[model samples]
Target: MIHSLDPAPSAQAAMLDGATPLTQLGVIRVEGEDAAAFLHGQLTQDFSLLGLSEARLAAFCSAKGRMLASFVGFKRAHDDILLVCNRDLLAPTLKRLSMFVLRAKARLSDASENFQVFGLAGGGVPAALPTAVWSQWRDGQVSVVRLPAAPGAVRALWVAPVGAAAPTATALAEPLWQWLEVQSGVAMLSQPVVESFVPQMLNYESVGGVNFKKGCYPGQEVVARSQFRGTLKRRAYVVHAEGALVAGQDVFSEGDPDQPCGTVVEVAPHPVQGFDAIVSLQTSAAAAGGLRAGSVSGPHLTLLPLPYSLLEDI
Candidate 1:
């Protein structure tokens, strides 16, 4: 079992903690002669220039620009790419992606059964892996990608063939890993909230999930308009709330309880508090007053500091 590195608090402590099985995530593999060329025309990132040593945070959007799914994608080989996303959306996401492959030589498959994903935090790499965010290294059939971590902490995603040798290092508890994921402020895409927000609404552009200069994809025009027009009125923010907060849950401002001011994009149980969540809401509402989840008398939410700056003026 994994253990904590320091006896501090919960959310922060988890980042400096050990490893855990990322059972909540799933993987999709796209391989063939046209993999790179095909994905370049679909996702929001510049996959054509994605080097073997690097990974990207990308979003697959609908024609209307709403994000269908978000992924931490990396190339396994010159013609192979792996996309990691929430398990619940894998099957449908794969199916939808396949439909667009029409004549491309690329093939999409649910590689979840063939691979086991794990999250490692506050620990040293396996000697064969790199320690920088988005950098990748390989050990046999297992590929490890250094992922963005909380401030002053280290984290990585380990993906290996199901039957391959598992990392012998101790792991952090799964709950702790989930909590840290929310605390990091990178909202995760789940089935309940699919096709909800545009990439910018989730702060994707600021976090390297969107490449504005890249060629067109599904909702390229809409995404471009939002950025260049400066008409985006909503953004994702970090908040702490009492009671259970879940993805797709509504957030309302006390000033106007009749209408929802935001939606809970991602949430997790906090070690010291009831729950921590990344909420996407109107900027004005977030700045006005404290938000409540569920109803007017529902649990009140307090906005917390986001680890990164938003691209509001862009």
Candidate 2:
């Protein structure tokens, strides 16, 4: 059954201050003169024109247009770029990315061990940090990238060398950080859902994750077709339910019980009660209501408002 629930006031208060180590994330470093150019040719964003003071949300896709990984990428220097992604996907993503390096003068390596990653929220975020989403601010060896704020809270990604001092704020639990991530409405790609979606299925194009004018990447043709042909039948939506939800789990709608109408992209326990998740659902099913998680007769899911507006289809 589809329904609406009041926002959790306490959860909003909790999001107002805290810092948490983002151990689930890992870093992939690409260095050398061709780093940006090489990545620009391979991913869904325009890395070749990427500025030093900006970070991009991008995706790596299979030729069939399924996302294998997603990244919050930025240039640390003219020749050094960093891709922050789920730790579980780092090794294989690095290997797959390296395959086409051929003579690009770029080097890819797992640099997770060389850095510390943290998620900062509200007052826990440095006062001087850039306020614009995707903008980057750096101080010596540390870098902070402003992320899209969740309801009632500002957020940023703090990355620094391993020995740098941690942010001095009330320690936020990793679970809270995960919940804020879901609240932000941007789902990061992880191992369980690898190859499960195309970039647009998750609204990547609307969120600065795709550059349609860029030159060809692996799935460029299919992605462009989905946009221009008006053939995209599925889209990501935020949802809530009174039960546990898992990534890659199937979502069913009473309108069509023979097969799943959606897939759970990411989920987290809601601070107040139950769970919140980002789900990619067939447009028709999303409109028909009666969404269930896991199985056809599983817990009912209620649609929630997305934090950001989706771009109009071109």
lDDT of 1: 0.83
**Stretches of model 1 off by over 4 angstroms after superposition:** 1-15, 124-131, 312-314
The local distance difference test score of each candidate is 0.83, 0.89
TM-score, cand. 2 vs. native: 0.96
* lDDT per residue as tens, model 1, 192-250: 78988999889999888999989999999999998888667999988887789988999
Residue pairs with backbone overlap in model 2: none
Best by lDDT: 2
Question: Relative to the unseen true structure, what is the C-alpha lDDT of residue 83 in candidate 2, on a scale of 0 to 100?
Answer: 97
My TM-score estimates for the predictions, one after another, are 0.92, 0.96
Tens digits of per-residue lDDT for model 2 on 1-314? 12234355665666557899999999999999999999999999999888988999999999999999999998889999999999999999999999999999999999999999999987888888877889998888888999988776788999998999998889887887887788788999999899999898999988889999999999999999988897679999999999999999999998789999999999999766899899999989998999999887898998887888888744
Clashes of each: 3, 0
